[model samples]
Target chain A: MHESPAVRGRRIKKSFGDVVALDGVDLDVAAGQVHGLVGPNGAGKTTLLGLLLGLAVADGGELEILGTPVGRTLAVPDGVAGFVDGPGLYPSLTARQNLSALASLRGYDAGRGVDDALEQVGLTDVADDRIRGFSLGMRQRLGLAAALLTRPRLLVLDEPANGLDPAGKHHVHRVITGLAADGVAVVLSSHRMDDLAALCSEVTVLATGRVVFSGPVTKLAAESGALDYRLLTSDTAAARRVALDTPGIRVPSGGDRVQRPDADVLVVRGAVPAVEELVVRLVRAEVAVRELAPVVAPLEAAFLALTGAVPTDEEVS
Target chain B: MTTTVTPPAVEARPAPVLRGYRFELVKLLSQWRIRVLLLACWIAPAGFVAAVSLQSVLPADTVFGRWMHATGWAGSLVVLDFSRSWALPLLTALVAGDVFAAEDRLGTWRHLLVAVRSPRRIFVSKGLASLTVLLLLVAGLAGSSIAGGLAAVGNHPLVGLDGHLLAPADAAGTVLLSWACVLAPTLAFAAIGLLGSVALGRSTMGLLMPALLAFALQLAQLLPLPVAVRLALPSHAFLAWRGLFTGPAQTGPLFIGLAVSLAWAVVATVAAYHLFLRRDFTDLTYDGSGRRVLVAGALPLAALVLLTFAVVTATTPAKGSGIERAKVEGSLATAYAHLYRMQTRELHRPDVTEAQLRATASCDKGGSRVADQGPGNDWRCVVSWHLPGATAVGTAIYQLDVTADGRYVADGDGPKEVNGYFQVRTSTGDAPNPLWQFDGNVDLLASTSKD
Candidate 1:
């Protein structure tokens, strides 16, 4: 028999008192897919993740996780494991003890999984150290290790890379991608567009407790209206003249202009097709197109256009 | 490419509740706070007994305090009595009050809730763990007190409240039973602490509220409430074991106290379980809005108190006239005889014979015409005894106070030459003997009259 989607929610609504944390939100996640959840702060990312993990029940609408429909009872579907609002841990316990405690609570022995998870998170060296002494990055890695102990088929993580160094981030990305390759459904919420762009096959953009966009990463960029680009060429004056002369491309005026006026670069704002047309003209005009890059990443530009504000650091995490 | 071996799935178990309980027990035992509290429980009582034994005079305010320095068994009884008043409740709260709130404090509620589907199961597991801890503390306190008492004072016959003497074995058993009797109320306090923990979501509130409630209830017992109302309070149950040390054991209060304690436990636990099942764990730091909890908790308590009041009002009769003359006369006569014999033997007096002394007593309740029964502070009794060198037989009027629970205090107004002490001639010598002398006061034994 074919397996159902790992998570399915239809117009799920959740409210706390007068504040609507989630409003008419719909989501679908399938096995072997990494679904990225992107939203500004207070956009209901954590609330939705909480619902998926069974830390809470949706106030209204249907939610199905791991093929089972969720009711009012607070319960995670089988094969679901993750953490929200950072992982909750006993500060006094060693990393190994924390994992062992969680394992024992679930009625299974840690066996070799504890060590394997620790090694996977690059925390094997400090496995015996109490969590009280762990840095934020170490704690986040330990949380991932804890989730791995369950051998979960569906993993939900909120800002799994919140405090990780570049190396730690690489390890986490590997583990998450590795899990997906093993047919696990992963739902990750993060503010880092690069990580999302790197790992997510599909992304869901939320704004004001509603979904603004959901599809492949390419669609998000394709749908964004226009973005500013930093252009560098062998001939700056020629590139600037060619760019301004190109149809549908405009050199931004006033305070919106590029900060480095003396440098051999031209900042232009226009749709991707228009920008492509300008690049074509530059090359044809023998003003070699040395470089062409959006000032903000396509994902981040789209996020800004969709959410109306640059994602704050706290929001990204 | 690398390959990994997948571990086998764990076997299914029949009792998930038991597993959850075991998990909770493990969590609690791993905490250093619990270990230290238990160690204090074991050692504090023994140290208290040792300190009290070193004092020349016994503490007379607490029940059995007068006998604390008398024998090991009595010392244990004194500690047991003191524990019932406050220490038992506090000890129970030490574990039960923290079991649930600690989850909130440590932000582990989300973790545990995600792993354990049913909140009710978690509640039960935590409750059971708290009970287990309480049992351990009680056992430690009891064991330590017994050991300390045995080492400090030698085994001796214990004096009962009704002037009856209990053998050494019976005294030991009675002491154990007294400790056992308080367990029912201690469990009730544990349930209350658990309820507070769930309702308040703070360990400090959970720990302090139950202890304060216990203290308040104990103070309420001092009021002249009807027996039924008194029986409803868990604190009253702590004193139910006092009946066991009487001439004929009063098991009525013992059984009633146990039932009342169980009732309170059931009510508190059920309420706590209900609240826990409905609680939202999404916000780990929610301090629980106090108004709703107050209403939830207050309704049940008000209903219970009103129900107790109604029952007590309907069933209880008016207080009896005063201490019964026959019961008091019999108790006083027997106690005086024992004291006189002890004095004569100690003084090496041989000429004074028990029959020749011929102690006689007459008692009345402040000149009332009503039947001499019940409890009062104004009962008067006159005793006439043969003096060693007096021309006429001496008469002394004793002012007596009787407590509702069947205890008495008596003060004698005799000639200055007699020094307000009961005097008798020794059997082996001509020296005069003083009876019932402790802290310059004469001790009298009183009995509860069966009406």
Candidate 2:
């Protein structure tokens, strides 16, 4: 028999007073799969993540985590672990003490693999320092270390890469990828498009409390409309002229065609097929197209289009 | 991605509540603030005992203050009485009030709830931990006071209420029992503090609100109201230990007081737990708006005040109605007999028996025209007693301050020669008894009729 999905939500709904935080949200993630959630501010990403972790209960609809049905008691399945809206920690306690407290509260032997978990998050050096003095990056890493102590089967992290240095982000990425390899289903929400594209095989995009897109990473790229591209050519004039003559390709105002400010650079905006046609025409016309790349990554371009507005601080948090 | 080896499964336990309780205890004990508070509790009694022992005059206003300088046990009793006013409630509230709100202040509620699985379990664990800390504080303070008293003043027979003498061992037991009695009300205050903490979501407010409320309630007891209304106040239980010091050990008020106090504790704790279980942890911000304050704080207070008024109205009779003439006459006769016997003994006239004194008293309220029956502070009594050498009966006027609770303080204007300490004979051939002396004023409660 096929194993059940690690998480399944059907028409999940939640509201805070008059604000409808999540309306008819449905999501699923199988074991060993890393699913990415992307949305602008106030798109209900945090609300959905909170539901998965049992920090909150949906006002209406079905939610199942690790094969257990969610209830109104705010209790998730045993294996669900992660942080939303920043991790909760005791500032008076040291990093090591915080983890031990969590372990003891969970009825586990605190001495069991606390050190290993600390080392996994690269927090072993400052484990004895009080968390009050810790930087945001350090606190975020410590939160990850706390979650790892439970050996969770399903990880739900909201902006896990927040405030991380490059090395800390690399350590987190490795840990998340390693956990997924061990059949731990990870559902990560982030605004960093590169992190999502690099880590997630499937992505879900939320807009205004509803799922706007859900599929493989490639599908999201395909769904993106015409995106701007930065083109570098040996013959910028020939490339600009070819672009203007093309059916669906248009040289933007700042391109060589308008100002000729940059001798060998051009800017174009068009669909992939039209850009390809331009490239083909340029090569056939001996324009010598050296390089062509979208100005922004497809995931970000699609996210901006899907969200259609800048996110407010409240929604981002 | 590479798969890592899985560790062995840890043994699972069924009792999450016990684990949560243990964790809460660890968290509470680990705080430096709590440790310092307990240390202060253990050490402050010695300084207080030393400071109070140096006073030339006795602290005569409190229950056992008159004898506090005369005996160590009385000194402990004095401390116990003083602490009941505010110190005990504040001590219990200091820890119990912060028990849950500290988690909110530290942003650990969500973490704790997610780990513990049951919010009720978390609530129970926190409450139990707070109770444990409160018990420890009480024990520490009691033990320290007893130790300080023993070291500063030697143990001696305590002067009981109404001129009854308590043996040294009995006095020590009574003092200890009084301290123990205060614990019930202290726990009630703790419950109040816990409720405040859960409702307010801030540690400072939790700590201060219960203490302020208890102080206000204690002040309310001093207001002129029916005896039943006063009895209903939680502070009434703090004075219940006085029953243990009285003759024949009246336990009616003690039992009733304990029941009232425990009922308050149970109600507050249950309400706190109910609120906690239903509260949403996602947003722990306390909205201290006018409407919220009216609903959360003022409504309960208004209800309590109305209930007190209703009880007073239902129980209190019309004017000129509380004290009965027969009861007053009987109690005055008995008290006069007791005091007159002690007086003759102090005057070296032990040959005079209570029967020889033949005390008969007539009492009136405010003035002779006013009926001698209502509960009022102004009361007067005329007593005719036989003096050993006098040819006829001697009449002395006494001013009595009568309380609604059947307690009275009588000031006698007798012979001027008997004002100062005089020679006393305890038994045949005993040389001038010095310790057992008499004052012009006497305090006593009315006698309970056996029928």
Candidate 3:
């Protein structure tokens, strides 16, 4: 409803003694958007997220959360609620008690709110059960439920999909999406590229505490450049022959150091048009292509490229 | 960006610190350890009384133990003084030492610190919650001890340090006041425990720290340290109650110890809060199941407080100069005459007055080679007095066991009918003869030179 972005951080710098956590990082997440942070270990993804949640203040930077500039206090703003690292839950308390305790801390008489949050996270079944016995996935779900209790306008979650089962994953996805649909801005960090692509409209790729790329997920997938196609066919010999003859399409050999052994699938590297040419030629040759797909998904490939991470053997081939 | 509208905000805005304290209190009371602590404090003293009452042998080593068979108040006092100085610090640690450290252990600091908005609030809330629990624990311990003692023994008169007899009503009042004075050292130790938790941020360390300090101080009592150093320690505050039962209620050490203990508490708590605020919570939160709930620790803050209070206490004259021979002799003779008169009344015999019975004591510390002086367990005294029907004077030989802190137990070794025994035949059934074996104390700081 307001003009300012839900979370706006500029040139943020945080250091622990000698190690720099976030250096000159700039982030802007609009309301009603699920902004994904993609980074490898120690890339300052969690650190940046921590600054937003007020778990830690930047050594230098300007941050505004929900129109309020974040201060040196170890607390989020009035409309902000999130957890970095993980939801720091009390294992001794039941899922319901954990939420109620947090709510009580905020002076919120969240008797019904606790039940609603638990039910919202599909944890109504184990609401009274202590979290000490909760599995990793269940804990993650409960963490989300705790964050939802405040009805945060800006929610920050670190690895929101880390330990979720299929059902739990779907439940979290729906909650995050629903929150965003209701005008909540969510910023979550995850190592899962699929999660980033599926849930986030915009992604920020951080490496060594600096944002290497920040834009729409669609624009990020476009940066993948070329593709490595895995061709599985009814006639492997025929498909392999057509792929070798096609221009701009080079079939990988067993001698290549990056070659991975595939018993019945042929790997080819080419631009989209070239791969399209090869597919047309294969169709003319009456070779039925059973499976033809990029060896690594586009978003993951672009993330691997932008972060300067070493490509996997399959992607390299 | 599209605007879909967010949910309505929560409107109530109470004081964050009060809310934080309430939350912490709820969480603290829910912990199994905290509950067990409360339960133990409630029942353990009663259990002690029950066990001690079943036997004839008195727990005579303690100040009030010898008279426990006569008065339940004495039994309560005995329990109150039994390892009191040593146990209180550890007990305080169990409640407070792990308070802040537990947040680190359970990885709940993120949630608590975030919601509370200020670390100061968190500190204050946790401190207040711990103090609340400690107050409850102390009340329970004191109440149960008195209840157990009254139930186990009847409300007979108790003996005080100056060998004065306290009526049942007076004894009850004194015990309550002693427990109140106990809060001085207790708060000091609790602050020390909080300092340990905040400074170390580890449960085991927090728990071990207060226990270690307590043991060290207890052991320190054996060493010939400077009296000034001894007077300054938070541990020294435990002995503050000694002055309360002394003749004229020697209040110097009581007031000094109260000031010293308060200084220790305030400074240590400040140091802990300072450390807590400066800490950066950048470490990854531990989600391990191996985590122990708020364990307990010690801190340099205790040492800092010790030296600080010590410096202040050092400027004053140090008490604990040991019981004087004359003071002991006088206290003993006065107690003997008082109890003898009371004993005659119980026997339905002719009444005797303290003025008529000229009781005098001649005591030697070690042997005939030594003059009657100073504090020692080996004291022999001849208490000669007059009886109403006897023509000649009667004498009672008493073996005196004295302590450096100005208390003694005098064992009567005369004929049972004349001096006393465990029980004596009285007109109203068998009754406790107050003249048998008696407990008393001399003011260590009382004027020793009787001119």
Candidate 4:
């Protein structure tokens, strides 16, 4: 094992004057694992990121990075690297120069030079170009390249995949996985549960600065005892009757359905086995299933269940 | 919980400070605003010189006027020095204000702290880098002004504050010294800008506040402070070298100005450093994670500047009767004494004493008085003196004006009181008639006669 609870926070509380941003929150992230921090707007997701970045100090807490305590004079502990809100970059500098500047800032040799880091992030062709000309996706990649220059052992990224295209998101997911495989602990905060589901082995759900649930994503699914399913059918009435007739299943009431107008799909919230049995019964009833998918992850569903609404991308961004 | 100690081989290594600082310095230099500010320091002076030299397009008495007449070039360049007295300070603050503040604006404060473990080195290195840039600018501006003034004005005697002619060498010395004098006070302003940057974590107000304060001080100095108060001000250093153009030079104010400027620079730098050390690192950069950043020592600096100005003004010497007498008599006695000593050594012996000089001397080589001394004698004399030389002695002059308000007075030569008729004799010169005569100190055109 690399260490103890990789990032341990006990009864952490922070406030800006009278406004409580983080209210007595406790979280633990272990090494060799990717932990997702999911929360609604003003629920202290960004505040938690700031603490991880050593950018903000908590009012009351016993916090540690790599088992070493962080106090008043908090320097981003050794082996820690990430963005709280967004990466700070020199706009006039080229993509390569921005990474080089950061490389030098952290005193890292950045051995292969700016070109090498850009190459790793698939930004090599445009590396020499100024950051001012880069698109949002390109800027995100540039931020990633700069962070990688440090070869951080503990990476804290806030919505790292927000502006990333599918390819870029895949690249980030792979890069984060690779860092974790090398024992670099990853703490990522994002509203995109699919990205979190794909990248994190463990997820920490926060609601109003308090941790509602934290553990493996499987544990969150098992603990929630349910999943939201999105089903499409040619014979909607037949599929509905079959789903209703199935044992341990009931048709989601209007109150339980989360309508998706754009997708034209009805979200049926039910127990995991009940929803699973409904899918089987629909097949038996000769209902043509055009689409069958979970609305989102059990963790995301659990996140909404605890917080009572979907977390918009803006909340993390 | 038992803490596990990792073997030496398993422990992670930390980053070095030198590498981090160099990176920071490079980033600072690469900033467009900083580069432009530095470039201006070098280029502005040269541009001013070139423009000034090409001012006159036709033949004229004044060099700038002549250039303008001959070449159709504007005279704007020749007056750069006058304008730069205020402009250079503002320009210096522009770059200095952003020195530490840019990091905060960019959200790199915490990032830098992570890289460099000690805040002290970061503070020192950045402060030094900014100061180096400031010094370079001062040098560039000074060089440009001196060279430009010479090229524009050529070898002709430059105009003085009192409109007297100044020879080329004298003018060069004055301009160069004046430019150098600007540095002492500028250091304080530069430090203030840095202090602002560190506290506010932003450049906009950092640059503006100091320039504004400097302007305010200039205005405050105009209030009813004593001559000593104004003389003691660091701002007086701004006008100190102007005295070099005055006829028969005096350096009292110049030296006083230099000393005061030096004191301000030292005190400001020390205080700025001390505050920087105790300040919370969280305030060094702006994350805006919170509503506001609380700078540890900003109020103290503002207080110090205000207090310094207030104390200086309050205790400033008053220009009363005694002060007026000291200025007038002091200048007069010194000038006369100076000329008297020189002439006495040439005409007679060098060892002549005051008592001997006062004794009655014969016009025809006989030990006889000019007139029989009596209580009612109207021909009474009063003698004052003026000193001489550039190194130590200063130039002064006295005038004998017999106002209608004049009453009976006594003479030092004889024990007699006569109807006052202001007969003035200096330590060296012959006594002027009971009318008005100029010995040396007061410029007839410039002086305001009370009577």
Clashing pairs in 2: A42-A315
Candidate 4 regions with alpha-carbon error over 4 angstroms: A1-5, A23-25, A57-60, A110-113, A237-267, A280-287, A310-317, B1-21, B53-80, B83-85, B151-174, B199-203, B221-234, B241-451
- Candidate 2, residues A68-125, lDDT tens digits: the string is 7776656776777788767788777889988998887665668866888899999889
How is the predicted docking of candidate 1 categorized under the CAPRI scheme?
A: acceptable
Fnat of every candidate, listed in order: 0.30, 0.28, 0.37, 0.22
Number of the predicted model whose lDDT against the real structure is largest: 3
Sorting all predicted structures by TM-score, with the top scorer first, yields 3, 1, 2, 4
Q: Compared with the true structure, what per-residue lDDT tens digits does model 2 show for residues B19-123?
A: 788878878887888898789778887667756765666676666665556567766777787888878888777798888788777777766766776777888
Clash pairs, model 3 backbone: B161-B441, B205-B297, B206-B296, B206-B297, B207-B296, B207-B297, B209-B298
DockQ of 4: 0.24
How high is the CA lDDT of each candidate model? 0.74, 0.73, 0.76, 0.58
Compare candidates 3 and 4 on TM-score and give the better one.
3
Across A1-317, the per-residue lDDT of candidate 1 in tens digits comes to 88899988888888888988888888999999999999998898988998898778787777888877777656665688888878888886789988887777776567688889899999989999988899888999999988888889899999999999999899899999999999999999999999999899999999888898888998987766777777878877788788879999877653123446555666787898899999889889999887788877888989998888854433322
Candidate 3, DockQ to 2 decimals? 0.38
Clashes of 2: 1
**After aligning candidate 3 to the native by TM-score, how far in Å is the CA of B412 from where it should be?**
4.1
lDDT string, candidate 3, B153-228, tens digits: 7777776765566888988888899888878778878887887787667647666667777778778754444445
lDDT by residue (B251-358, candidate 1, tens digit) is 655776787788778778887888787787876558855664576665786676667546544544312322367666655544454445455555555656546666
Candidate 2's TM-score reads: 0.81
How do the residues B18-61 of candidate 4 rate in per-residue lDDT, one tens digit apiece?
A: 66556666776777876786677667765665665554332222
Q: Flag the better candidate by DockQ, 3 or 4.
A: 3
Return the lDDT, model 1, position A284: 92
